[model samples]
Target: MEPDIATQNDSGQDSESGLSLRWSARLSLTTRILVVNVLAIALLAGGLFYLNNYRDRLTEERLTQARLQLTIVADALSSGDIANRDALVEQFASHLGARLRLYAPDGRKVIDSFELAEPTYQFVDPDAEPLRKDAARMLDKTIESVVFTTQIPNFSEPANDVAGAWSELETAERKSAAVSSVSYAPDRTPVIVAGKSLPDGAGSILLTANARDITRIVRAERASVLLVILVAATISILLSLFLARTIVRPIRKLAVAAVRVRMGRSDEIAIPRMPGRRDEIGQLSRALSDMSAALRHRIDATEAFAADVSHEIKNPLASLRSALEGLERVDDPDLQKQLLDVANDDVRRIDRLINDISDASRVDAELARAKFEPIDIGKMLEQLLAAREQRTSNLGVHIAFARPAKDVAKVMGDGGRLERVFGNLLDNAVSFSPEGGLVEILATPDGDEIVIHIADQGPGVAPDQREQVFQRFHSDRPDGEAFGKHSGLGLAIAKTIVEGHQGEIRILDRDGGESGACFEIRLPKAL
Candidate 1:
């Protein structure tokens, strides 16, 4: 047989949920929380990488400025006499914070800034630096490695220390314009070198500057950013752990309790309701606790039902056995016939008991899956009373239904089950009423509910027995009624169906000082 639509949908969901869900299921809640928090700080840490590009842009700007300054200085010297060129070069060197050199057209060294003036800057030897400076340089190299910054040649003076050894000057002479290049000193500081050809080919001038301040500024900025990121990351991790503790711990406890319940140890496990918390988690806790309690109640009810069924079946079986045994020992034809009738009645009673038990057992499951529609309580009662008047053999007992207006007592319920509920109640009232007595059924709307009362003018039930009458296999029939004529499950099934519909049913003393039992049923309105 083909599976129902609900079963098919459940199977499809279980199979079609794909790899991402499966993979995520393997990670604990704690790991997911940590990953989410850490990823944010990692994005913030990316700023350190951009600092490398910032340093490069600053170096390029410095190189362009130096080349322009050198070209202007060379032009000044080219327009003056050769006797004053050395003094002019020295003046430019001191002002620009660079070492300046003037060379001849044949690439011969003419004047050197250091020979004429005190040196303005010197290259730093990394090995002779303090520990703090060493740490700073290490950090610079680490950042360069991480960002894959382009390699620059290390700055070194050639053995000849002349114009022929300087590549920038050769390029400047050939191009007859300013040219510049960058290199790194021993301490990983930038070295900017700019050379320009003098006006009318007087010579090429070279200016070299140790741009240590640029490296210092970039490193300091990087350190500050790194410190902030470290602090933020530490706080993020701690908070993530704290959040995991608060969330995962309670969920874990709930999971363990559910497992125990599933293992049939519900008697020993008490699922926490977490009443102090007012969040979704607390709601889940209370919901699960209530569900477990309901399950336990259901289990107990099933056990009691089985016991009652066994006891009820045994009495009829024993009577059947005794009648059959007595028939074998008797010889009189009338006695044998009487025994045969008793055996037939006991067999019928057993069949009736089995059918009633089956119906009682199925009431809950059927109502759970039943689809409810809007039913006018007054109209249903009118039709029911008409049908009963036609078929009912109890002509001496009259049933009067005080039906309300159309649509006034509308309710949402399974029509067939509701019909059965009222049918059972009406039959019960008819069986209890005296000859020429009245059985009254009244349906009316009371605000948000449809109220129904089935009262009979018969020996009323004692106040103490009202609750017991709704329990399974509880038969308290009227005196002189045939034994086993009613299985006693009708009222119990009625109560179960009413409760399943989110309604209520109760037995009360008849109003207006009447001597009868009143069965009152209240169902929610359709709207």
Candidate 2:
């Protein structure tokens, strides 16, 4: 019916659109990656910040518990606790979750439950230590000025009533001995020491709090915080991927639209839009549509104008030819001859115009339907040479054909068209050659094509004009000049015919064989 391809093909092909999308996607990748990474980084940072705050609060709560435990041991050891200093220190160590040591009034260790060393935690010797004053100041920071005894009555009051029963012991050691009840070992675990005077002033009381458990819990809490940060980073990566795709989809559509517009198949391109988010792509789509519409309109107008001009010119030529035929039938001899010449000139000019129009119109068809067949190029040239030599022998020009090897110079062409092309070349050579000069036809094979050189011993064309000599209405000789009635379309028509046969025709250098103009035609061998 209408047309098979018209029914089959899409309004715009996907190949062009797909290529544009691929390039646009590549161009956008840098910005897309940046945006995705930025969002992912932001999410990671937020998660890390939350985890840090949570760990900070938890550690603070644990430290607060440590502080309260420190206070109970301090209050208990500061008062005289029991008759046996060792028994009292042991009891205080259990309650305070610490190590204990009791020092006598002379600073000798009287009872030691927790082992003490010099480097990490040193026993406070009020007399020998150079840092005793600073150490006492440090002690004050750990101890409360007044005891809020209600929080841990079990350890605080029992140890306090025991020290109260040893009032005589308090006199020698002073409150310092009871304070020395808390001491240090090699490691830095805060040891609560309850130091007291034994009822007979034998020893002091000490109690200590070990800090290793609290340290382990702190490290574990930090690890938990890092785990939360890793989880947050993973979530952020996923979210960023989603956002990047959403933003890139519309851009991809715009890319496809541009390709469709460039292809000139359809002006209709639909762009996805958000009502309130009319952005750059929306403006671009509108602009492209307008341009496409304008181009289509201009092309239609041009075609119509060409058809009208062709029609108008054809009508005048027809009328002019009819008038010339009427003039040929007149009785006046002189006027008839003059009118005939002018009419002939008009006819030739009209023919050139018609040929130009025909060539321009059929260019598409010629290229598409061009096919080649085997042609004996040397045989064809020799035959033409024989025919022309007999006919033009009276013109004083010699026709020569170079015999080529049988299969070496085989050509492929339209036989009739090739004959006309050589005829035009022969006619041109005959008109231009000097008296007794040679016109030669030589055939040689060149790769996939056969080269035929037709050389005439005539004045070669000017360098600049050699190429234009094949254009319709282009002539080197003037009207009624040396060459008789040069229509100027012979070479033009020859060139078209040769090209329609998928061959090339050109002017070649004429040096070795003869100093003349050489016209070369190259045609492919038939498959």
Best by lDDT: 1
Question: Which 10-residue window in model 2 sums to the lowest lDDT?
Answer: 148-157
Candidate 2 has an lDDT of: 0.58
- Residue-level lDDT for 485 in candidate 1: 81
lDDT of 2 by residue, 145-200 (tens): 23221121112223433434333235425643333222222232233333334335
lDDT of 1 by residue, 188-247 (tens): 898899888877767778899999889988988888999999999999999999988889
Top of the candidates by TM-score: 1
Q: What is the lDDT of residue 463 in candidate 1?
A: 88
Which lDDT values do the candidates have, in the order given?
A: 0.88, 0.58
RMSD of each: 3.8, 17.1
Model 1: residue 397 alpha-carbon error in angstroms: 1.5
TM-score of every prediction relative to native: 0.92, 0.40
Error of 2 at 485 (Å): 3.4
